[model samples]
Target: MTADRDTLPLPPLAPDMQAVMDRLMAEDGVQPDPTLLPPAEGRAKAEAANRRWNGPAPAMARELIVETPGGRRAFVFIPPSDTGREAILYIHGGGWAFCSAATHEGAARRLALATGAPVITFDYRLAPEHPYPAGLDDCLSLWAEREHILSGRRWSVSGDSAGANLALALMIRLKNRDLPHCGLLFYGVFDADFESPSYRQVADGPGLTRGKMQRYWDFYAPEERRSSDPCLTPARASDEVLAALPPLYLNAAEVDPLRSDSEALAARLHALGRKDPFDTVPGVVHGFMQMSIWLPQAEAAFDRAGEAFRTMT
Candidate 1:
């Protein structure tokens, strides 16, 4: 089925989420499908669309940028009254092609408040220009210098969608070294399998669609390397790597095509006798957490993730 928003049958979204979606749809009515646009144009449109939900960001005690390798940027969001040594490294999701630290500023601020600790986000290289190991390398560069930049704080990793994929991949890359204290993944894209149950069920979306995701994969990883590269498709990581990951807090939107990815990861962890928390938020679509300013469920999800982080730290 085509991913036509008007004709696709979708599960009901929460009232607030429905209202937010309606407003976004109206605003985007004149624009072509971003997924089909040129990378630069698509990035611009995605950034502009996210600005609405970011609404007067939650106050931050401080904000700053640190330059990483390749002259890429990393942004730090520090909440008021934060005194702990714990922090979060938040990675923004945009199918590995669109969005940036600026588009995700509000969500990072909210995360800082939710966890009562500083939150850091960065601008990784986008695909179809840099592709594959480039973005992951940028993330790794920042991680290597986290101590100097974060002032020796104990930090966990957190991300949404493709960002979550990278976060998990980072963990796999560090499986034999120092891992993050915990992980908070939201509706992450964990695997490349387009035939998964959720993929077929939500092939066309009120939000994320299977076709869009396929394009994202094509841009991010060459077909020859997709299945073999654990960093590209993290779910394919070995059982030893999976079992060695730190504590995790995962959630999936009920109507998201990526929902099953989280489910599969959680199941793998369970089989390893790990009791990590996995929440499935009903009545929402992928990237709903970006609407935390307008959706209570979004805020609540952050709160829950914060709680999970605290327990592990």
Candidate 2:
């Protein structure tokens, strides 16, 4: 799909999503700078946008901050109709740079409401300051310390964008350990390759672009070690590692630079005999999950994902 100079270029978006995109373009503008900003400011902007896009938090939900190992804290969302045992460990995406559990609370609440399970999200250290392995270490540390409690009934690992990358990486890291029952990856970054067809086709985008993603990678994983670290780039995982994963549910935005990542990963999984379900959300852009309140496609994607979660758990 072609991008427009003054507006979001491409095929017509879902009627409901068109309005959400229009509002986003009007508020944040068509072209993004893609430059790294002060972490605090980036977080503030994300929080404000999340506030505007997501409706009020669903009622009968409880939120708590629990201390994890290494003095880090984790955020958890418990739905009103609590089952008390099952939960999902959701990781938020901000290119591994910005955004925290707080900024992404609305999406967490929506996931809990849709799946009928509680959700837990944590703050991993951001990059360009903490760099590679820092965020992953935080997640692993917390999981190691609290997996028993979190694994009460059924627990799965789920995330979007960089968060999805981390989720897959965690599975690879703990492949021999007690892995999650399933995974839900939404428009993730699986490889460092910038020349994929989707990247070339959507180089300049309505939301995320190839150049912006490259900048994110550079800040998170330096050029010297990125290619060698499968954890940093899950696509680099060997066939042996890919074959050991649990059931996965993946979805890509029809018009997104990272669209190819999901396709490629699905192909890899298929080749390894893990023919899991992979889907695409047509007429949407990156970060569409956060727009569930306004975009029908986003809600539909979540509903499909909820079904996958239910079937696996």
Candidate 3:
């Protein structure tokens, strides 16, 4: 599989970021798999990573505690310089296993910088401990209850990896109830199928592996619950809904196993006669967004995603 940088020559990174990259490359030890725990523990790991954050050059970030219908959620708030700008509802990906408002700090800040839109990344419930629908329910429930807080402005929803699935799924859930998002930006999304081209091709891709993905699904959706909902497996969704869906833009990394899901989804949208946008970022691996320390390409992709989103808003 090709890397993201091979397909996209990203922008130059800052000096501190370059130093961080150098230090990481100088190390000789094997990199431990980072996605190795449940949400709470993984999120704890993120806070530790926060200490190393050099901060994005263009934007500022702060965490907000949003009171959802079910309970409190940690929302990382990145206000655009323009307060009157559009708002972004973002979801972080860890297959609903390990991800937090802290983990996405730099990424959210960069997003705000590029889009000039207020970005809010939420900490939705995770699975196994909570199980199927519990986490998904928390995210969807947000849509029903958050409009009043937006001050009558239109909005967009976006997320990466499993979080991307959530964006697509949550929108479907919303559309079922006749609610609409101005647009959707989905990146590196995973589908429920056990077999796909990338799954077989990049079965052992760095940052993410096949066995680990299966483990996440095992934790996210138990057997009885896997049968019907397309949210967990958006590819399994019907064409009728795909056609009715709002404008969407999907980004797929060539070296990631989940690339197939994005490709398959693009195909489905085309077959349904939809005009959703799609792009394939090559020369990068899965989870590169978090690899900003060692991978310049990852940071660039994040920037590109942010810039592209600004226009849609």
Candidate 4:
């Protein structure tokens, strides 16, 4: 009973966003060339999703090759205005399986302009193919090579969706290495259990859906080691480890299932006096930033997030 890829249903989506989703589904990418990684294909789809995005004139943002002792990884560099050169290591979100430096070009360019920080956005390895630790390694290597940027400096870290998850994983990794952190998240996933209150309350709402999330994890989480690693799912990590993370600016869309992941984690951090900044954007849905015109509330949310990222660092 094998199913044809072309016939697969598009995931349940937000009504406000249905037209865009329909258009995206219509121009479906040919199955990727074998030379391309699965993550690369996912990124292509995201770029196609916003084919009309002619974002701000970036000061300067371009693809870069970062060669580290660990390995060669790709990044998109958005240089800050020379007036005051701050830097942010930006991670683009997917469910740890999709999106990349290319998929998130608009957000990166706009973010650089808004925060006035040179942005280095990475294309971390995505999973079930790359699996755990591979993507994590790429993420940490980008930061380790830039310690001068992160140490007691105004260097901030930010990402949306699964990249947000990677950001937190990097914080934990940095702490373990006895390094400093400046991590922020936009509509992040902080838990793996997925049964938190927000999950139940917003599961059927616009944007992200429970069934779709399950599919995302299916593609991202390899069978052999899915539950054992905290890198893939931070909620499974102990509270002590989660508390030691750096000051964070976490946001959630009002109708996003991950909203509770943000709320619960923020509460824990607040209780422990981590005092991270967390916000719930009104009238927004999961992955709203991908279609700002379709989800106007996201622009304001992103603006507020930029402010928080500036201050948190």
lDDT of 3 by residue, 152-198 (tens): 65677778788888888788877656444555454555466646777
Tell me the TM-score of each prediction against the true structure: 0.93, 0.90, 0.80, 0.76
lDDT tens digits, residues 1-313, model 4?
1133224323344455566556545766333322134556655665555444535434564445555555645454555452344567888887777666777777776677666666676677777687667787888877777644333445668888888888888887776664445776888877655556666666554557665566566666654555566666665666778777777788877767787778877787777767788887665568777565445555666678778866765
Which 10-residue window in model 3 sums to the lowest lDDT? 4-13
Candidate whose TM-score is highest? 1
lDDT of 1 by residue, 1-313 (tens): 3444335456677888789888877866656667898888988888888777777789898888877654656788889968868888999999999988888888899888988889999888899898988888888888888876677688789999999998998988887687888999989988898877778778877788889999999889888898887777777777887888999989999888898899988898888899899999998999999998778999999898878878877
> lDDT of all the models against the reference?
0.85, 0.80, 0.66, 0.66
Q: Which stretches of candidate 1 lie over 4 Å from their true place?
A: 1-10, 68-72
* Model 4 local distance difference test score: 0.66
Candidate 4, clashing residue pairs? Answer: none
List candidate 4 segments past 4 Å from native: 1-44, 50-85, 147-154, 176-180, 222-228, 293-295
